[model samples]
Target: MRYGIVGTGMMGGEHIRNIRLLDDVSITAIADPVESSLDWAAQSLGDQQPARFRSAEELAEKGEVDAVIVASPNFTHRAVLEPLFDRGLAILCEKPLATTIADADWIVERAARNPAPFWTGMEYRYMPPVARFIADVHGGRIGALKMLSMREHRFPFLVKVGDWNRFSRNSGGTMVEKCCHFFDLMRLIVGAEAERVYCSGGIDVNHLDERYDGETPDILDNSYTVVDFANGVRAMLDLCMFADGAEHQEEIAAVGDAARLDVLVPPGDLVFSPRVGFGAPKQVVREHVAVDDMAMEAGSHHGATFYQHAAFARAVRGEGPVEVTAEDGRRAVLIGAAAEISAREKRAVEMRELDTTG
Candidate 1:
């Protein structure tokens, strides 16, 4: 299969590298407005030459590709996807499907009518340990799950092509920008839709002294968001973008009546703690999940990009189902939109308030 990458930035280059690892697949084309990004993609492509275009429109018109991966900036997703959708090409759009709910709703509507497969790229779901954790939770390892909490203590956002991510207007706020991955995971693990969202976040640490055109960055660096799912499942996210010194960049825990399950990303350990009476012998088991060396080397996402691409390839070949659909992307964006509103308004926002389906 031949693939075309819409944005040739860091994530786009990651996709190119991992796609090269897939059998019988090649990155046939790439498009980006910035020349430096195009050069970066070229470097990643090595000797394999793919047709290069300056814009998605140009690529859609001139490039020959079986499927397209939209890794463009958050604000430009809807615009970049237009021509590709019109061409009836299979698409794997990166998450927070769109910066706003209206655009996400439009994408959902269009995707439902398209004949080709539409995939939302939620890479975290494919992480080996996280995938196992999700399966174990659903397999009744954690019986009657009561609470879910996630923490991402990582460095600040890296430099994009044009500093497009420093502002909420372009990146969809920190909640929708970075937290969408966690929100998506929360929904997937809990197997329920979010009913309400409450968040307290602000631009506390990162990018304080940075200025673009005399305007300081407005994106939040830390946050605490609570999501109330329809099935009475409550999830909380504790995000600290300034805590790069921490040992684990991401950690997730799910507690139930029976026990609690936890997964740490770096070492990729799954810990199971069963309910034991006080003073009883504690039996806490820790198992390490391993990822393919090549897949791990290909990207920073702990081989998730490779696994997600593998699944996407199967979907394109009619060998498997599209695991993450346009609706899934929309729902994730809805929860994120609510979180952003809640943080700004200092109140809990009901899911119905942002229900674009109606």
Candidate 2:
């Protein structure tokens, strides 16, 4: 399948690399507002040269590709979606479908109206360890999951090409921008929608002194949120941006009435064995699955990003189903957006109260 890549930033570059590894999938075109970015792509893409465009509109007008991979910033998803609407193009858009519920609904409406092959980049579900966790949870390895938690202890946010990520309006608040992966997986694993959220965090030490000439520093560097699910299962997120180069970048696990599961993704290997107990604490036992050498990270999802693209490619080729449907992406945004609201208003925000639905 021929692909047109929008936004030649870090994500765009990573997608290009993973796509090059696949058979019958090739990068035919690339689009970005910055000319320097296209130059970077030209040098980075080695032997394969793709047609360059200044915008998604230009690429869409050309109509030369079979699919479009949108790796642009969060707020620009709607702009990218506009020109491609009704074109019956297969699209794999990045997460937080849009910065706002209204915009997310707009994308959903068009998908419902025209019915094309479309999906979002909630790539965590495709991770071998994460998928295993979900399977183990539902397969009764961890009988009746009660609570889930995820922690991301990493360095400060990476600098974007345009610095648009510094402001809330442009990046849809940092949680929606960064933590939506965990949020989406939380929902999928627990098998329920988030009923409410309570978040406490601010631009505390990491980027507190940062400022542009005109823009305010609104993105938070740390956030702690407790999301209550409709099924009475609870999930929590502990995000700290100042602890870069710490022991591990991410740690996630779930606890059930009968047993528990944990995952840790370091740089070189995904060393995480599921320890489940059928009875008391003394009966805890470890599963003997061999560890996978994940020795790579594409935009911080670790080895899962490549798997995400593979799934998208399969779906685009009519060989598989679209797993990260539009609603899945929207619900994740809804939960993240609510977390933002909870932080701002200093109160628990009900998911249903927001102008969003999944």
Candidate 3:
């Protein structure tokens, strides 16, 4: 299958390398406005170099690829996507599908008319340990979920080719860019749509010196958001971008009436404990996932990224259903967008207050 990759940044470049590992899958074309990025991609592909286009639209118009893997910036998905929906091509679009509900709405509207084979790139679901935890919740291992929480203590954002990432406006705020993965997982594990969000945090550190001449410097470095699902469940997300060398890069826990599941990272694994407050004694079940010890520090061990791509490739080949739907992609963005607003205004934002339908 021929795969055209847009945006040869870190994530895009990762897809190019990992996808080529699959049999019969070829990196057919690449698109990125930055010449250096294109050069980086071309140099890596060597004799197997694919066709290059400066813009995604040009690649789409050229008709050289069977499927497209859109790892473009958060705000650029729609531009690359709107042109290809009616072409009946399969697409694996990266997160925050449109960066905002309005853009997401636009993409969905156009995408619906074509019945294109579409998949959202949400790699967290493919994480072995996280997937197991989700399965345990859905399988009734944790009855009637009540609360969920996740924490991400990692290094500052990776530098993008353009400094577009330093601005929340361009990157759709820090939550939309970084924490949407956790939000998506929370939604999946909770099995409900978020009805409201209350957030608090600030642009305390990280990019204080990043006063880009033409842009407003308003990106956040830390945040804590509480999400209330429509089903009466609650989830909290704590994000700290300055925790450079924390022992655990991420962690999560799900608490239900009957049991609880706790997950820890950098050796991401799970522990399930059944029978809480009512019982004095508890049985703890642990799922020990053999995660890479240096996954986070080395910043290159994204097994989930690889696994998710395999799933997308299968879907592109009409061999399976998309693991993450466009709606799922949009909802994740909506939650992040709302959380950002709530954080800024210091008020709870409801789904009704947002233009989710548009």
Q: How well does each candidate superpose onto the true structure, as a TM-score?
A: 0.99, 0.92, 0.93
Spell out the clash pairs found in candidate 3.
Answer: none
Local distance difference test scores for all models: 0.94, 0.81, 0.82
lDDT by residue (297-321, candidate 3, tens digit) is 2225446776777788887777888
Better of 1 and 2 by TM-score: 1
Ranking by lDDT: 1, 3, 2
lDDT of 1 by residue, 246-341 (tens): 999999999999999999999899999999989999999999999999999999999999999999999999999999999999898988889899
- Cα RMSD of all models vs. native, in order, equals 0.8, 2.7, 2.4
The candidate scoring highest on TM-score is 1
lDDT of 2: 0.81
Instruction: Tell me which residue pairs clash in candidate 1.
Output: none
User: What is the Cα-based lDDT of residue 308 in candidate 1?
Assistant: 99
Tens digit per residue, CA lDDT, model 2, 1-358: 7899999998888887777767887788999999998999878888888899999999998848988989998889999988877577889898879999888888888766645578888877766666766777888776789999999898887889878888889888987988888899898889988888999988887767777995567888999999999999999999999997788687777888766777665532223334434553454444432323441434456567778877888887788989898878888888889999899999999888985343
Least lDDT summed over 10 consecutive residues: which range in candidate 1?
A: 349-358
